[model samples]
Target: MATKHEILSEIDTNFPEYLTFLQTFIRAASPSPPGDTTEAASIVFDFLSSHGISAETIAPQPHMPNIVTDFDGGDRSGPRVVLNGHIDTYPVGNPDEWKHGGPYSGYNDGLQIHGRGGVDMKAGTAASTIAYILLKKRAQKLKGSVALTVASDEETGGKWGTRYLLEQGGKASPWRGDCVINGEPGGLQSIRFGEKGTLRLTFTIRTKGANGAYTQLSRGANIIAAQLIQRLLEIESMTPHLSEELRKHFDSSEVRLVANEIMGPGTAEILLAPTINIGTIRGGFKVNVIPEECVFEADVRLPIGLLAEEVMDHVYSILKDFPEASVSKQEAPSNPANYCSIDHPFAKHIADTTEHITGRRPVQLAGLGGTDCKFYRYLGIPAYVIGPSPRSMGASGEAVDIAEFKALIKIHTLAIWDYLGSNA
Candidate 1:
């Protein structure tokens, strides 16, 4: 049996190969919206095949392929572990806005890898791929299987990606695993066990149109829009009920201190309350005209233990004051807040492994944003996230420190081995 140090020493010796893999992955542009992950999936398939690991491409939609592969353990009765990461990245808005490199440049300064998806996820995906290969080499000595799932359609919501793979109600879905470890750039200092839910609402206001000179005579739709914005902002103050176990974890001095370090000051409060963001607004055709109709969108995120229905009730209660404004749930994707206990065996093993590697114990917290892990949680399988803290996720100058990237890979490799090898 290879000790943890032996496994890490091997990873360190082959760090260059891992770095090259990540650079190649970053160079392949798999942006969501027109999310065509075939190019990236092909890269993954080729890499796995070259290393004697059998993999297959499953594309429910054209050009959106999901790469699935697995290594069997010695004991077939042991649990199966899933290693997951998204291939598609947020679309780079404007290439010219990038001061460092173009979105797909995959520029490496021997210190950091710069590109749109470098940190947002391609790096994590690359790490998981390498980790899977490492685990495969030791499969004969292990007691469970390790399944690798590189998914598409995460940035724009995973309707055609993870959701289809795991919950399409199909008979022979290949995504069935006992637990999932998603490498989604949550930072090495934290192991995210939960994520906030999304409820996007679009508010529309319509009123009688009138000329610009008609003051106090016309009901301006813009005025009603402004009032709705005020009410939406108030949702931030609404408190959420946290489970006693979660609350106890949050109140711990260690967790609070680590949360502040990883997520910035006041992050604790943000995680405990519902958050509202007015994403978009469109109204008048001209500056002078009293607009007859105005529309705006608000993105509401519910904390763990908070139901979307409860948040909607609060929204409706606030809307009562603005009778002229009508709001409707948009076609935007949404799900209730999901979580797994911090005390779960898988979570604890990850935390212990992380501490062993980094000497800094990771804090367990509810993720502020969403990830493909939510789908696994929906299936009652516990999912956890631990990866590099992306310096630039969706904006220009996106990159991940190469040092941290390697460290992240080490963490994933060690943790996966620790978890799957426990039953050996």
Candidate 2:
């Protein structure tokens, strides 16, 4: 097994180069709304190839591609660990909101690396690349294997990314593994053992249009859309029906403290609760004439103990009141909220390894947001998350601390070393 000091020293020597690698990756910019990762995927594929590493590109949809690198150790019987990270990030909604050369600018000031995807994930994906390189170099001495899956569709629920990899049998499930370690930003204060689920509903309301003066004949579709938005808020009041174990997990003082510190005040209490957001509301063609049609979308995220069906039930009950507004579409890509026990071997390995390197043992808690992790967890595989803090994750000024970025590489690399080299 490799010593912790040896790993740290090795990474430190080439740390500057690794930072540059991350900066280059961020500059490529993979945004998911338009969902084209060809430019970003090319960077990852080329970087690995330049290192004399072999990787394959799999794209169910030509626009969104996945880069997968797989290599086994001397003893293939040992547990296989999958390192997952998504290159695609939330679309930069408004370029003007970004101050430091816009979202794609991978700016570095010696302390932090700034970009839209850096905090959300590109930094971690870059770290995964470096770790994979280091692990592949020592494959002959190691036990099982390390597979790197840099996904492209996590921002919109992965129809063509991680989920597709799991579904592929042509490759004989090379991407499936004994455990998965994802680099979704969990703020490094906690090892996210689980995450909430999402249920997106698009409501469409239509009505016959009339001039503003003829309001008495028929109400505008916008009127009903506004009412539906208020009704969606009721889902927030739906309490979580969690098992005792999950309830106790969040109730722990240490877990609550970590959750609060990582996200914000009062986050712990709502870690397993529903959150409703009317993300998009488009209605009224013009200001003067009554609108003929209105379409609005609501994102209702369900906590671990709760099911999407229960939330849908509540939504249906509310929709019954407003027959004018109906669900035009629903995003069923969401999996049920899933988790691995905190004491699971892979989860413990990550926590212990991180504590060894960072001097602080990360608490175990369920994340408030979603990640590619749920795809693994839903398959009865243990998936753990550890990465840099999510500072301005989906908004402007997104960034990751340079030191934290370096720490992530070290921890992920050594943790796999510790696990694959272990008897357990």
Candidate 3:
């Protein structure tokens, strides 16, 4: 039997090959909103198949393929660990805006891998893929199996990706696992146990139809939309009740210090409040036109312990001030907040592995952004996220530190072994 130290050393020896795989993945473009992940999925499928790991590509929609594979251990009585990663990335707005290189350049400058998805996911995805491959080589020494789901369409929302794979009503859904470890960037110093829920609502203000020339008689929809935006901004100041567990952690000086180091200042306050962002507004057809209908979309992220209905009630209260504005819950895309206990055995194992590998204990924190991990939590499976720090996740010069990337791979590899290898 190979010791954990030996396995880590093996990873160190093959670190260059892993970097190549990451770079190759970054080179393949799979941006959302026209998210065609066939090229990227092929890269993953080919790599896994060539390494003697069986994988299949499943696509509910054309041009968007998800790769699923597993390694069966000799013993079937132990826990099953699922390693997941999203292949699609945020779209690159303009190539000229990138300071390092093009979004798909996959540029490496000795200390970082520079690309659009390098930090946001491709680095983490590559790490998961490499870890599965490494573990398969030692499958005979394990007690449980390991599964991989390289999903697509996570950025815009995972309706067609992880959500479909897990809830598509089939025994062969390929999402069977006792716990899931998602490779989404959460910084090396923290492991995300929960994430805030998302609720996107578009408010449409309708007025009596009028021609562009008749400004005096028309009740301008654009004016109403502007007033709604002002009122929606007030939700930021309203704080919600935090869970007892979260409040306890927030009161800790050590946790606050760690959170400040990882996420910025006032991290505790942000986690306890529902954040609202006015995403888009479309109203007038021309400068002089008073449109009959004006629509504006707002994205509301509910914190843990706050229900969507409660937030919607609060929103309704605000909307009462403007009778012209209304919301249709059926048209809104919403999901309640989900979380796993920080004291969960699997979460503890990940933190322990991080401490063992890097000499620093990871802080337990709630993720500000949504991820496919939420879907697993919805399925009653505990999911945790740990990856390299995202320096420029959705920005132009996105990249991941080479050192952090290497450390992430070691941490994940060791943690998976510790979890699936032990009978407890």
lDDT of each: 0.83, 0.85, 0.83
Number of backbone collisions per candidate: 0, 1, 0
The superposed Cα distance between candidate 1 and the true structure at residue 296, in angstroms, equals 0.5
The numbered model that scores best in lDDT is: 2
For 252-295, candidate 1 gives per-residue lDDT tens digits of 88877767777678877777778888878898998788999999
Q: How do the residues 38-88 of candidate 3 rate in per-residue lDDT, one tens digit apiece?
A: 998899998898788888877998688889988778787778899999999
Q: Write the per-residue lDDT of candidate 2 for residues 1-424, one digit (tens) a residue.
A: 3455666788999998888888888889788888899999999998899889999999999989999988999898899999999989888888888766888888887798888899889888888888999888778767998999999899888879998998788336888898988878987778998888878788899888999789887688998788778778888888988778778878989888888888989998788788878877788867889998998887777888888888888878988888777884475555677788778887888888899879999998888788998888888888999999975788778888998999899888888988888332
lDDT value, candidate 1, whole model: 0.83
lDDT of 2 at 150: 96
For model 2, the superposed segments whose C-alpha errors exceed 4 Å read: 97-100, 207-209, 213-216, 422-424
TM-score of each: 0.96, 0.93, 0.94
Give RMSD to native, each candidate.
1.7, 2.3, 2.3
Model 1 pairs whose backbones collide: none
Query: Model 2 RMSD to the real structure?
Result: 2.3
Better of 1 and 3 by TM-score: 1
